[model samples]
Target: MRILVTNDDGIFAEGIYDLAKALQDIGEVIVAAPNSERSATGHAITIHHPLRVDKVRFFDTTIEAYSISGTPADCVKLAVEALLKDRRPDIVISGINNGPNLGTDVIYSGTVSAAVEAAIMDIDSIAISMGSTNITQYTDAANFVCRIAKEIIHNNDIKDTIININYPTCPKEEVKGVKVTTLGVRKYENTFIERKDPRGNSYYWTSGNVVDMEQNQDSDILALQNGYISITPIHFDLTHFKTFEKIKKLNFQK
Candidate 1:
């Protein structure tokens, strides 16, 4: 079993390293990640600039790792297309992400986007995230990730879906259990702060607090908030079949 591990967080981030270490016992782990933090970068792939990859020392001597100068999506693209050209990985796992990618947050998350890219290429993929900003809970998240990956690798019925998981910020014992959920909506109280530079030039900094808009009981955000791991299956097909049929019923100028 070969696994390609990646993260929106830089190659040196604690989350990625911990995840890699956890999965090393499972199979051959090869890591390809951004050279710097690329959080919330979405599914952007580089087509203009030339990408650069360099071997980096991650764990003392276990997994083969590389630092990539591109987005999270680019790492997976280059890994399969360039690095592991002869042998495609059996599965791709993106992140024990430093933060949660619940609800609509996945739309802007490079962590989840990396997994989406793998799914686009018809590869089995999963994205793991921890709800807390603290790094201490990553082990618990990694354990769950390992479990899911093992299940997918051994089970054939689990194909055709990208698994998105989020672990709450609590002790492993406090976790209730895993909950299969749907995507919830989350809005943010966006704010911009203006400051003066050394030359008295005005600069603006963008920041926002994520507003809790969760009302659905079976939502990913709600599940995580209630101390349960959230698992949401994501797919790339954006067609609104119901809406398409409704529109098709309308007679227009053909």
Candidate 2:
């Protein structure tokens, strides 16, 4: 199997590095990631600015890698459309992200968007994230990824959609188990601190604190908090079928 790896955490991030190494045991892994961090940059593509891709070696062994001057989604796009045009990857895995992409957070996550981009291209995709900001939990996350990826690939029937996995911030043994979950609601109270620059001009720094929202026990958020890995199958289709049917019942004469 051929695997394409990308992330929003930058090409040299510890999470991505560990993830690439783990994935290598399963298939030929090629990484094409952003040169710098592009967190929360949802499914953005580079159209105005020219996209640049450079081949470089960051690991001790020789591995095909590219530093891209684009968003996480752009990495996958460029790799499929240009870099590996003839030999496209069988699967695209994004992240091993620095932090969790849970609930509604996935909407704004570049990590998840990278996988979404691959799914749009009809390729099997997975987004891997760790609940903690610390890099120490990455090994456990990578192991979980290996297990899940193998299950999905070998099973065959599971490759048609995108899968999001968020590992809890706990020891491997401490993790109770894995749960297939649904996306939950997550709210945040945002704050803006106004400050003065060297020239005395006003500048505002954006910050926010996550406010715990009411969620079901079966939700991804609760699963992670309970020391369980959460796997949520997601898609780009936003059609509200119920609403469509409701509106269709209203008869409006032309």
| Candidate 1 runs further than 4 Å off | 196-202, 251-254
Please estimate how well model 2 matches the true structure, expressed as its whole-model Cα lDDT: 0.91
All-Cα superposition RMSD per candidate: 1.6, 1.5
lDDT of 2 at 25: 89
Off by over 4 Å in 2: 198-200, 251-254
Residue pairs that clash (backbone atoms under 3 angstroms), model 2: none
Q: Residue 149's C-alpha lDDT in candidate 1? A: 92
As a TM-score, model 2 comes out at 0.95
- Per-residue lDDT tens digits of candidate 2, residues 1-254? 89999999999998889899998888899999999999999998999989988998967756799999999999999999999999999889999999899999999999999999999998989999998786565887887788788887776777557899998877788889889999999889999999999999999999999997899878999999988889999999988987998999888986
